[model samples]
Target chain A: MRVVYDGTFEGFLTIVYELYYQKLKPTVIEKSALSYSLFDEVDTLVTDETKALKVLQGLQKWWSRKNLQTILNTFMCDSKSFEMDLLKFIRLGFKDEKELQNINHTSVFAIRNLEKEFFRHYHRMTGFVRFQELEDETLYAKIEGKFNTLYYLGEHFSKRFNNQKFIIHDIERGLAFVHNQESKGIHQVADFDEPIYSSKEEKFLKLWKTFFKSVAIESRTNPKLQQSFVPLIYRTYMSEFG
Target chain B: MKKDIYTKMQILSDSAKYDVSCSSSGSDNNYKTGELGATENSGICHTFTADGRCVSLLKVLLTNYCIYDCAYCMNRVGNDIPRAAFSPKELADITINFYKRNYIEGLFLSSGIIYSEDHTMELILKTLRLLRHEHKFNGYIHVKLIPGSDAKLIDEVVKLASRVSSNIELPSNKSLKLLAPNKTKEKVLQPLKLARDISLERTDKVIGMSTQLIVGATPESDRDILQLSSALYDKALLKRVYYSAYIPVNNHKNLPALVNKPPLLREHRLYQADWLLRFYGFNWSEIVNEANPNLDEELDPKTFWALNNLHLFPIEINQASKEELIRIPGIGVRGAYKIIAARRFKRLGFDDLKKLRVSLKRARYFITCRGKYQNEVALYPEKIRYALLEPAKPKQPTLFDINYSATTGEL
Candidate 1:
């Protein structure tokens, strides 16, 4: 049997709940739905909030809150085999009746590595988000990150820019995290036209570019080392790079 | 020079680029709702420069004019470089704008001795006052303390800025006399010492204090530099000791000739040993003795120490304590904890250790799996030393200034 979830923790937990309750063995668990599969019985799970919460509380009994966050980080890695990996990890945790992450198990190790990979990208995005001021004084930025990191960055940025109005669009995913000081929401933005910047925006951009270029020591110029710290993909939206 | 903000920023930032303390990690200043900025505990690097240095803050000098002719300084009074100064208003404006756009975490303000030490310091104070009170910018600010500034001024600096540092570029008083006749070891450390005492007395959030030591500049050994740092940490005067490879910017007869490149590899090795001192629970005397005053360029300090004391090694991986575990090569503080945690579930064999991400390459020679050595290299010190030699890395010829030397005042 195949299980399709809604690409969320709650959805994945609902599938886990049904897997235990119905005693169904799933060969493939994924976020995408297949079109008209003849051989395999495909089950699409509607995210049941009660079942998801129950599963979460069950996991909490065996693991600390920090370990639970690690599991969420593993899911956020968005790896091809993350669903199966997390499933095996959850099973191992219940069977062992202890924290499986510290157990030196293969499945646990794989989940931990994926968690590290996800945090690495998320941390880089926190540094590289370059916001330009729009005409109405709203800070605007666009990102095309590798994973669904939009969910994790909202709280960090909201706390940092608490009083400012800003819109950060995950351009590749067609989603925008809009914050207007008091209220914030993640909306599916189908048509985000090129924005008109504030009058002082150009002047500050020019000054920043000048400071960036001049700060590099001539004798210590190494493009290779610079490239290693910041890869080409993250530099796409950075104003100082070009 | 009658310069625009653009021209002044370029010159001032270029002048201040040599001050290689780019860390913004120490302070997490609480942010009010309508405040201009907030601080991250693990400070964000907005961008990496072409030199591969972290551009965390808008590092710039308040002014580049000087009256003293320090032999190693690029902005010495005698040098014919273009001079510029940012008025208090201009600097505060730039910091606010940059923080507003998320281009920088905050400002790193340094200046030369313009007119006098107090005069230059007061100019820096003016800028910080505007940034703190006028603009309410609560981001992480790292201001360079001019060595001989007044105690009152230092208190004001601690109040406004999130982090402060005074560069003791010359490692010793003898070297100070040779290169910078105006500066002494006492003068350089006075403000840092006073600031620490005041922070403790007032029970305020004692900000991070740091100093820079220019490696391969004078005839100071790694032992000498680390001893000074260890003493500073003992007195609680310094949270960090930055090792900048001596970039020969000036040509004085007393200083090293300008032909040699900055000791990048030696600087890199010192940084490795600095970690051992601060985090790995190694002392300066253990790291280097009178027999070997300098760090070995070929092997890291930890490997060198392990080779020197072969009797301690081949520590049982499963049974060794945390201190003994960190002594083995290729196993860091985190790796040691992983070993301790994983071994509780089962006895960790070589394959199981590999699963835990421990490199058995350098570690195999130093560690044994339940009294059974993994490698057949015979566990001889000289033979293991020959086998464990790191392949020399090709020099990048660029500044890879990553300092992991800060500890309590955490990493």
Candidate 2:
């Protein structure tokens, strides 16, 4: 019997229990769009709230709550071979609690990969995020990142600029959060239209461009090194470079 | 005009190439209004060059015009070289433009003495001040302290720069007198002492200081170099002491006739010995003696120290403390921590050591794991010396270098 899920963690956990309790053989569980076989019988599994909670509660005894959340998030990201790896990890979790702590195991590969990707994005944003001053006397930034790391990045930027009102626009994902003077809040915007620049801002940017041109040592001008830090693709959006 | 610029650049860059400490780290400054950009304490590694050097900062000299004539320096007054000077505005603009394109972490500005020591120091300080105040650039800046600059100028420079260093070109006073008559030991050490004192006083700021010593310039022994470096570290609280191997550039009557190249391997050995002093807690007397001033070029400094002190060997890895682990060859601070953490979970055997990627070739002679190992090496005093010193066959070249023609497929 083949089972189809709604591509959610709860639905997948319910399918795991159905396979175990019903003692079914030749079972395959897949997301909705992944179903292509003509001969197999497909039963679409609905997300059962109570059964999913029971399975998660049982998993908490073997793995820490944080580790379970990491595994679930990694699965929701739609990684390759995630279902098979999750199944193996769940099996190992039943066998020995110590197996959950081993990071090098194939079962925990998705969690480890997600952590690496998170740190990479965090470091890149640390260097690449540029803020521009708008005509309304507010600071603004735009980033087009692959991961949904805006909340974590917002917390970092909040700590960096506590007294300023700024907005970070996710150009690729079409989401932005406006942090006002008093508190920080998230908002979704359709797209960014270029804000009007004031005369003072234009003058300051001109002065900045002049200073940038002056500070580079002609003796040590290496474009190859420059390309490594801010790649050519990012140059089009950068004010000084443009 | 462009050819002249290129020529001056080549001369100045070649002159400034020897000083190795170019790290722009451990500071936090944000771009304010009118400034080009800002800096972060978490330093950026801009790029690695063809020579495997990390090009982090725009390391350059303000001018290639010197008053003093150091025999080993290409920019010495007697050498025939083109010279160039950038106005403070020019320097500030270049830094801003390069920073905007993300070419470098920041600026590491040095200079050949233009006129008087005070005049040169003031010019460099003005450039940095303009970059900070006028340009609003809060970036990593490392400035070189001219040997005879006024104490007040050094103080002002330190406030604007992230890190400061003074080059003590030769280790001893005798070598400084013979090669560079204008520079004395006291002149070089005085400004460094003032910078160190000020940095200590302003502990809240991100202050880092370092020094550089030219190796193989004169006949000063490696023992003298290590002793001086150790004193600088202990007394001056220096972050690093760079060793630059002397490259002959000027022809002078007082210098030795050209015979052999500068001993790069010897310089490398001194760097290792310096690292041992700084990180491994090994004293100079333990590593070197009065008679033998040079380190063994074939083996590393830590191995040499371990070979000399055989009585302290065969330490139990799991049971030994962190201090004892640091003394063993091939075991760094990180390796010791790994051993400590791994042993908490399971009893570490030879297999576990292999898994941790510890260098078994050198470390096997020094450590015992579960009180046993496979091979039985020499334990006797005389036999162990021969075993450590025996020449081994060279291994094949790495895959990165091998089959160059086939990989490139050049017709």
Candidate 3:
């Protein structure tokens, strides 16, 4: 069976419970609109607060509260092989509370790998994510990330520039958040079509690019290492490379 | 002078690139009223390159003109190569410009011997002093102490700089004579000892000293290197010891012909072993013996250590003390702490370890729950070694696996 969730963690947990009750082996559990499977029987699951809370309690019984939170973070972030590995972890969690502790050992190495990946991306974003000052004097940023890390990113940006008014847009996911000098909140927005950059913005980018190129040692150029650190995909948005 | 500066900077910096301990950590002090910039003690990490080398500082050389012809050094004076030297002012200007743009954290300046030991030392000291006093640059400066430099000069450089280092080049004095006749064991050791003593005396703003040794250069075994490192750590009070795998840059009658790449893997193993010695409560003798100078090419130092000490396996996860927990193959210092913190609230078993995300495959052989895996069939050391060393084949991804999106945007 294939299950389509509401792109929400609670909705996925509801599917987990449904699979357990029905004793059905799910071939795929994906977010709504993302599933393209035709052969498998698909069930669209709605978010159930009660059922989600029960699952969270069951997970807490076996694993410590902190570990359970990490697993939940993995699930919400939509980690690779999360569904299969999480199901196996849940099964083990029930057999022995110790089984949940051993989640690091399971064949599904996705969770730990995902944690490193997320932290690495987060670290890169700290340095690489650039904000441009608009004609209106408000800062704007456009990012193209594979994961829905907008919430976490907002927390970082808000703290980094406390007094500045800024808007960060996730172009791929079509989600964005705005933080003004007075208030801090996260809200979903439809597609944004902003005007082209002013001449001053273009000049600053050119200067930044020049500065970047000038600083690197030509003799010590290691393109392989540079590519490994900042992948070609991220180069699309980086002011120096783009 | 400008051309001299550029050529020398390129040669010396390129030569110094292989030395992996260029960290600019400790004490944060910025320029008050000078030309430009300041230093933050947290040590800014500008970027990590493909080879995983951190580019925090402007790692370069003051001159590539050397008096000693070390076989492993590309800039050896006898080698038929172009030479260059940077005046103190030229170097200071480049550092200031780079610092202002936030391209580097600080300057990591090393040099080849120019004119004499004292002369080369004076030039380096002059550049640093200008950067600090005249330029009022407060960034973390890691100056390389020239062996045979005057004690007073070394003391002055240490006071003006955040960190000072001198390369031992080779492990033993015998190897030093064979490869670099100009430099002896005392020549390298004296400067390092002087830096250590001065740093100890002035602990307020003084950062500690570090040293590097070339691996796979001579016949000295890994045991010899480790013993030397252990002594340096215990006696010299050195902050760090870096190992650079010998790359054959110069060919001479005295040097070995190019056969294989300077055992980069072996160099990496030594670093792992070094970490264990410093943090994991391991000793030099415990890691390698006289007969086995090198570590296993395949397994990490910790895994090798665990396999060698099999009798201590299957220590109860909940019961193992902090010291015993550190000995586990998969558990690091952080992992051990997590285990301790988690177990305090609940009785931890095999499943709990998985949830905690410890590398259980390596740890399983070394740990037990309720004395269960104590009498399990132990695999032959060769088989275990093969299993540990052999790289696993990449598994073909299933349709479901392919469809699954990675959380952090990485493939």
Candidate 4:
């Protein structure tokens, strides 16, 4: 049987609810946007807030809060098979008492690896996001990350630039995490035009670029090693690379 | 040359790059409600330079002008290089601006002494006061304390910065006198001890002290370096002891030739031995003794020790204590803890050990899981050593192998 739902995390929990209530084993768990085979029986699961919360509460009893968050972050991997993989992990989590903590299990290991990759990308974005001081005296940064990691990056930058207003725009996802002093929220911005940097901002960027270039030792020049640490893709957003 | 701020930054950062103590860890201060920055316990590397070194902090010198002509230093007084200095306001502004952009975790401010040690240190203190008070920036700041500076300056700077260091440039006292005539061993150690004492008394933001020692420049042995490091950790409560391989940045008859490589392998071995001394509870005497004065470059210190003392091998994994488990070559501190915790459920086998990420390729001869030997053959010390030294797998065959395989199908 094929199960389809919206792409949000709540949609995933709705599928888990159907798994227990309907007593069914889904052969394919996919988003509603994906096309299914004609021979397979398709069931589109609607996201019910109450049902999703109930399933989350049930999983909390057996698994840890960190484990539950890991499952949710693993769902954000954007791979084709990530949904079914997370479903298999949650089903295993519901079994014998200590099964969830067992790292030897393949399903558990798959979700753990997904969480690792997601956080790896998230942490890189925290460093790569370079904010420019706009003409209005606000800080702005734009990133094109591989995953939907703007929310996590937002929490880090918000706590840091608490007194100043800043905007972290995820160009690929068309979302911006805008924090104005004490108030912060995510807004959907369809297009972000070229930001205006004050003359002082441009000068600081030049100084930073100069420092980055000069700090490298001339004797031990290895581009391969540098690329291994900060890949070429992340450099596009960094001010030093510019 | 009339250098602008950008050119001055280029000169100062290039001068500061050789000091390889870029770590920003050991601070767990989160962002205050109205603060502009925060620090993580594990530290964050924003980028890596072309030399494969982490660029965690904005490592720069306040000036590249110096009075002391240290033979190994690039900014020595005798060198005919362009000199530049940053005003107190300039550095504080740069640090706050960079911290906002997430370009760095903090500022690692070191400076070449222009006139006197006290004068340079007071300039550094003025910059720190500007950052902490005027800017209200609460980020991690690691400043280097100038040796021979007054104790009052050291106390004030320690309270302002999150961490401080007084680099003992050379390991031995004789080397310090030979290469650095202006600096003595006592001058360096006095500030380090003062910082440690002041930090121990305070319960607030200050976190101990750290120091750096340059290797391969002097005739001091690795044994001497480790002995100094062990004492610093024991007596001074130093947070870290950085070992920088002596890169030939200048030419002097007293220093090594420019043709010689910068003893990078020896530097790496010293770091591994340092890790063992700090976390593995190893003493300097155990790692390097009076008889064996140098660490083995071919093998790590732990493995060499394990090979020398084979009578302690084949430690029972199920029954061994955590300390014994760590002494084994393959099990790290984390792996030892995992084994102790997991063994409470059931006796672990070889497969279970592999799941915990134990290095069984090296551990097989030394450890036995549940009394079942990984290698059933009679273990000879020389044979096991040779087998371990052999390459894990043969290098990928060249074009000749394809020709040989095509002709020798034997169909």
lDDT of each: 0.85, 0.71, 0.70, 0.83
Per-prediction RMSD in angstroms? 4.4, 7.4, 8.6, 5.1
Tens digits of per-residue lDDT for model 3, B162-241: 88888887898888888888888887889888887787787743356788988876878888999889888887457789
| Residue pairs that clash (backbone atoms under 3 angstroms), model 1 | none
Give a tens-digit lDDT track for model 1, residues A1-242. 88888888899998888879978688888797857568878987899999999999998887778777878778767644688878988887777647564657777877887887887888889889899999999999889877768877776677778778988899888998888856888889988679999999989999999999999987666666777789998999999986
Number of the top lDDT candidate:
1
**CA shift at B95, candidate 2, in angstroms?**
0.9
* Pairs in steric clash, model 4: none
Q: Where's the lowest-lDDT run of ten residues in candidate 2 chain B?
A: B402-411
Q: How big a share of the true inter-chain contacts is recovered in candidate 3? A: 0.07
Best-to-worst order by TM-score is 1, 4, 2, 3
Q: Which candidate wins on TM-score?
A: 1
Question: Number of clashing residue pairs in every model?
Answer: 0, 18, 24, 0
> Global lDDT for candidate 4?
0.83
TM-score of each model's chain B: 0.93, 0.90, 0.88, 0.93
Q: Mind giving the per-residue lDDT tens digits that candidate 4 earns over B1-411? A: 678898889889999999888888888757888867888777789888877788989999999899998998999999998889989899999999888878898999999997889999999999999988888888889999998899999999988887889889899889988899988999888887888778778874346578889989988899999999999888745889999888888899888766455677788889999999999988888889888899987677888788878888889999999888998886789778777866776788999877766678778878888888866544666766776787657667786543211111111
Candidate 3 off by > 4 Å:
A1-122, A125-229, A232-242, B1-12, B26-44, B50-52, B204-206, B374-383, B386-411
